[model samples]
Target chain A: MAVMQIKFIDKIGEGTINKIESLGRIALFFAVGIIHIFIKPFQGKKILDQIVFIGSKSIFVIALTGFFTGMVLGLQGYYSLVRFGSEAALGSAVALTLIRELGPVLTAIMVAARAGSAMAAEIGVMRISEQIDALRTMHINPVRFLFTPRIVASIFSFPFLTALFNVVGIFGGYISGSVILGINQNVYMGTVIESVSIEDITGGFYKALAFSVVVTTICCYRGFYMHLKGEFGARGVSTATTNAVVQSCIFILIVDYAITFFLV
Target chain B: MNTPLIQLENISKRFGNLDVLKGINLSIYQGEILVIIGKSGTGKSVLLKHIIGLVQPDSGRIYIQGELLEELPSAKIKSYQKLLSYMFQENALFDYMTIYDNIALPLIENPDVIPSRIREKVFILMERLGLRGIENKFPAQLSGGMRKRVALARALITDPKLVLFDEPTTGLDPVRKRKVHEMITEYKEHFGFTAVIVSHDIPNIFNIAQRIAMLKDGGILFEGTKEDVFKSHGKILNDFEMGKEI
Candidate 1:
């Protein structure tokens, strides 16, 4: 039993080391992908197509997430305001929380779960079938030829998406407070605009950037190195996609907390 | 004569506990076709990977033009990458790209190769390989023979010093296999590039290989000229020749 315990500990240590090494490779690939943007200019149509797929197609989900997130914030803020005998401060509370913390983090988690998983699966299949190797043999770095454009598009698009989320979320809170809860519209808007600083908006943008980096890096890493050998096929690709989504969602939450802790 | 262009000295590789290659040693001069024959899972493809630095050996050394491969940094390794091309067993064509884009990929990615020259070379190679009209078609739309030809065209686009073919005729019908063999021979004659092909197609490959290396149990069992291989009397070779265990 003692020997078995020792072996278990050793296995855990090895697993930890493996995770660290994988994360290091992910960082390296992310840097390589960023550098590739300047080095190899792709066709404009390809870039535009990716933008449409990743950004425009994602708007509805982001808006839906924002609406629910704002409603929850308003409900929670109203209860807390009533406890403090300051119901008028509900608008300020909702605005501050949404712009500072919930907006970017929630939107990123949703998109990463939905779109990032599909990207990983597609690329993972490409990797397993030697399509990535073919690209290498053809003289194109897979990072440049395949991943960089997507990464760049995500970097630009996610922040814009986050901003859209914040806007829709604030409108959601406005509808909930002014129309349903019988608060004045002018006062609600004024309180929200006053309570949320430019710094808060900037912080959300920073978090969006970090979340973009995490999502794309994890997804691309899982796809690019799906299996060490060729044994795993479609099943492996599916596993990689699931892992990418889950890992990136966890990473976004953790990084959001860390960034908010430091910035706010 | 001139210190063989490529050399493998006691190269060994392992995946976890399973040893894939056990001390492989071989050499090939420039402009020669060396066919490697082995049953499935005997590391024939693994050996080809080591030649181009796609898979590194656990021990031993590989030399291309006498420069030790493992010692070179990645930037230098990439310089070597440009000089070699590998055609995967499944043809591994990028399914998303059209045949023309797939063929043009290597040329477009290499900074030294200009676009106009790349276009010219791609069209010329397409004509040569009988892929002239289907340049815009995706790999999914093309027949197996055409996909193999596109793969060949991509491999040759860079004018690599060495071209590696992995099971080039494994899935094709006999007629398609013959056409592929003819293409291989024609390309070898036209470009004079060194070719290393891994195949179990004994009867078909015998005509193309100047020399043949037979591998079994993670090591080379026999290495000799085609005539010598046929004349040699060993159970493994005899079984392979008789199509017993292939």
Candidate 2:
């Protein structure tokens, strides 16, 4: 019985050590990648290419999701506010919810699902295929060649995407509240304009920026270090991609909560 | 003879519970084609990786041009790395890049490189390597043999002082393999760059190899001229040269 307990404790200790090591590695990876961005010999062309891939290509999905999200919020908010005879305030509620919370969070989640997974898979494939090693031999910094541009693109992309989501979401709310529910259009627009402050907008942008860093860092880290994870070949790449998306999503929510807590 | 372009002293590497390279000591001379022959899973690629600084050894010292690799500053290390180019066994071409972009990547990344010069060099290499007219095609769009040649072109594009070829002729037919060997010889003669090749094409590789190193059981078993190998070991080297699993 004593031996069993000792063995169990030993196993737990080993797992804890491994987790700590992994966290340290990820933190170092993110730091080095961020440092590379500010170094001389900037990757302007590659950064532009990534901006097109991560930002321009994501517009359709962001618009679609934003519209539906705001519609749902308008519909749901109207029904609930009506119970208190406060349905006239439906626009403020939808605007605030979309701007303060759902806009950055959902946009990040969508981008994580779309672009983050692709980044992980792309870098993971490069890792397994020894392309990253090839870059090293050619005197190219792999982090600069691969991760720096993606991180820079994400930084330039996320807030713009969030802003787009908020604008489209407000339009969706207008469609559902004024057009469908017969609410006074002027009243709805008035309340929406009145309720949103500069703080709310800037706060949302801050969240977008934070989530972008988290998502890009985690995804790139997973892929760049896939070889060190004791996995190889296609299966390793697939596993790394899945883990990148899942971890990004989880961290998004966690970061969202933490930011909201501090902001509120 | 000339302070050995690269030297490995008592190098050892361990992956998990397995010892990949156990106390390996070898020297590579400048301007010579040294082919390392070994069985599969015998750490040939790992040894090559150490020379290129891709894999750090657990216990060892590597000297580049009589200077300890580990003791060099980061800037010096980068300069040394710039002097070397590695061709991966699997032809690690960027699948998303066109053949032109793939061959020109090193130069494109170099801030000192001129745009016109990059195009000129890339086109010349493509023509010489018979990769013309396919410059716009991605690596995945090319055949295996064509992809190998593209990789070779990319490796040679920088005019590196030391070129590491990891199984450069692995997936080629006998004729293509011989052609690749001929190309390596021709290019080596023209450019005068030192070459280190890891291959299993024993007799065929012998044609271009100025010196041969046989790696077995995590250490170098023999290191000398091809004639030295043939003359010294009647059975072991003969079996290895015959593609027998020793």
Candidate 3:
């Protein structure tokens, strides 16, 4: 009983600390956002580079994930609907799921795992090497100079990425149902277009916005506070990167559930 | 000469059970080379960190130009940070950025500096440091001594009132170490900024240090002019001179 009580108390303490850290991260994100407004985005060649990085380069992964997600939904919904003799409802199920939940959550997690971790690692390395401190001594706020562009880019790009995912996913479902399962092309297309409401689309977009903030904030926080109380080396940086991804993934899921619950 | 530019009074810092700096008091004058010598793990770096407000003292007061640093707001503290520069032990040049970018970082970050003028200043510093042609080269591509020089150039780029060097010559060959020592002297001469160097290289520092402070067991064991330091027969000083622990 005593050990259990101790564990409970420890958990409460941990939760409180996490809450404070979350608030701090929110403040940092807003701070970066404010700074980004003052600084102009990359000009000419640099703008082209960022466009290639955040948009064109992400196409293959985004499309692949979207397609697989749609096919999986089609396959699963088909079996469940057949039990109820409502197999035609597969299109509705696939469309709703793709727009309301899978679109934002999956894309966010994928980006967090790939790009977010890399950003954390890059910034973490900079922190440990005193490059961040060098920036401060030079009178440059690291938040404004280093983090603003990333946060701004993520906010700008993530919703579009989710939209791309949703469109591709619905098409994948169509290909699987119509081309492979012998459903009529007109029926599949009509069901997807008609069943996917504006509410569903708007809900997904909102979740994408939240997911972008969560992932970017967590990744930036992990990098910013990489060495808080003690000295952390390469191993620490790697661990922080891993933790950032895992935490962001978990946060994405929880936020997805909350948004879905409220939207429904 | 006219009230030391920086002062630490009753400064103490403890990391858990270990006390790193114990009630240390010192004052640093402008345009003077103050070398702090001690054995490894003697809190030399910690002392230097306190001066720059990087690590706050546990129970003491730090003043820059008679202004209490710890009591100041963060924005006020930030302004003070601009006047001081620290060259880390590892020559902490950002590895991902090119040499020119690393040197230009301070200028780029300062809101007061225009981007066009920043570029000009960076180029000028690069030229002066004999690093003009290697602007695109990363720190990984530079030699250890060259990296140190680049870091020094970055520190001096801001034209700071004070510059802190933490083990500036630790991992270099003798020739390279001498080169760094000479560079420190040259920078002091050129910029006329106060310097606080933490090092174990006694002979090299003796050439430039106007005053010397020896740290041991989280306290200042001795502090005086170079002539006084050499003339003293204190046991710890003598032991340190003879490469033995007291």
Candidate 4:
């Protein structure tokens, strides 16, 4: 029994040390990855390619998500405000909710699920196939060739996706409030226009930008270092991609709350 | 005496509890084909990776072109990488790229090579490799032999002085294997580049290898010419010669 207890304590100590070491490596990957942005010999073509992938290809999904979210917000806010005999505030509530929170948060989640996961899987496959090692052997830096553009593209895409979501969601909210609920159209539009200030809008952009960096960096880091775990072949890539998506989602939520807290 | 183009002194590496390479000491002459052969899981690839500075040694040193690899700064190391090319065992072709683009990558990355020169070099290589009509097709569309040839083309496009090949003929058919071996020999003769090959091709590689290094039990059991290995007697060497892994 005493020996068992000693073994358990040793396992805990080892686990803690492993966690610290992993965190340090992650921090190092991020520092170098971000610092590469300012350095010369940037690949303009690669960046453009990634932007087309992460930004343009993502528009349809973001629009659909935003429209549905706005409609739901308008429906929910109307019912809630009616209880207090203040149904006039329904438009403001729907617009504020869509613009200040759901726009950035929902867009981030979508990007994480769609683009971030794809990035992770693509890179994870590259790692498993030794294509990454091939790049290094060819005297090319994989981080610069593969990753910097991805991170930069994510940074470029998220804010634009967030803005699109806000526009579509606001329209959805307006349709639900005016056409469906019989709230005055002019009054709903007016309330939404008046309720949303520049600060609230800018706060959401800040959240979107921060959340993009966190998700992309974490996902890429997971995929890039997936080989270090000593696992090989398809299982390693699958596990790496799974970890990337799950970790990206978790970080997006955490970053969202942290940014929202600061803005509030 | 041939000057040592690359040297390893007391190199040792351990992956977890397994000592993959132990006290590895060897030298490759400036213009010779050295084949390092071993059983599967004997760290032959790991040793090849060490020469290119892809895998850092846990202890010991490696010298390339008279410069200690580890002593060079990261930028210098990258520049030094231009002097060498490593053709992967798995081919490692970019699945997203066409065969033409794949071969063109090394040349395109060099700013000194203009677009016309890049196209000229890439097409010439493709033609030499019997890959003319398939330039626009992606890697997934190619056969295993074609993929390997494409990778070889990519490696040689830069005109590197030293080339490392990890099992260049592993999954190839007999005809394709012979073709690959012939290509390596022809390229070496034409380019006069030194080669460090890791293979299990046995008699097939005997014709090409200037020296053979037999690895067993995580150490060099034999290192010399093919005739020297054929005349010697050892369990590991005989087993490998007779197509058995000990």
Candidate of highest lDDT: 2
Q: How well is each residue in A1-264 modelled by candidate 3, as lDDT tens digits?
A: 999999999999998997798688668666765566567533234334544665567777988999989988887777787789877877888889889889999999988987789878888888888877767656666776656666667777789999999989988888777777876778778888889888888899999989988888788778877886254989879988998899999999999889888988
In terms of TM-score, which candidate is stronger, 3 or 4? 4
RMSD of 4: 1.9
**Candidate 3 DockQ vs. native:** 0.56
Top DockQ prediction, candidate number: 2
TM-score of each: 0.91, 0.96, 0.90, 0.95
Per-candidate TM-score, first chain only? 0.91, 0.97, 0.86, 0.96
* Residue-by-residue lDDT tens digits, candidate 2, B1-246: 679999999999999899999999999999999999889999999999999888899998999889998899999988888889898899999999999999999999998998899999999988888889999999888888899889989999999999999999987899989988998899888888999999989779988999989899899988998778778864786787767777
Per-residue lDDT over A83-109 for candidate 1, one digit per residue giving the tens place of the 0 to 100 score: 877867778888888888888888888
Candidate 4 residue-wise lDDT, A156-194, digit = tens: 999999999999998988888789999888888889889
Q: Kindly indicate the candidate among 2 and 4 with the higher lDDT.
A: 2
Tell me the deviation in Å of residue A192 in model 4. Answer: 0.4
> Considering every candidate listed, which one attains the maximal TM-score?
2
**Candidate 3 to truth, TM:** 0.90
Query: iRMS of every model, one decimal?
Result: 1.9, 1.0, 2.8, 1.5
lDDT by residue for model 1 over B96-156, one digit each (tens)? 7899988988777777887789889999999988888898899999889999999999999
Residue B159 of model 4: what lDDT? 84
lDDT of 3 by residue, B1-246 (tens): 567889889889998799999999888998889999888888998898888767778898988788887678999877778789999999878887799988987776556778899888888877877788899999999999999989988998888899999999998999999999998999788888899999888677788899999888889888888888778835666677789867
Q: Is the docking of candidate 1 incorrect, acceptable, medium or high quality?
A: medium
Residues A1-264, model 2: lDDT tens digits: 999999999999999999999999888888888998988788899999999999999999999999999888888988999999999998899999999999999999999999999999999999988899899888888988898999999999999999999999988998998899988999999999999999999999999999999999999999999887788899999999999999999999999999999999
Every candidate's DockQ is: 0.54, 0.85, 0.56, 0.74
Sliding window of 10 residues with minimal summed lDDT for model 3 chain B: B233-242
Q: Which stretches of candidate 4 lie over 4 Å from their true place?
A: B71-77, B111-116, B234-238, B244-246
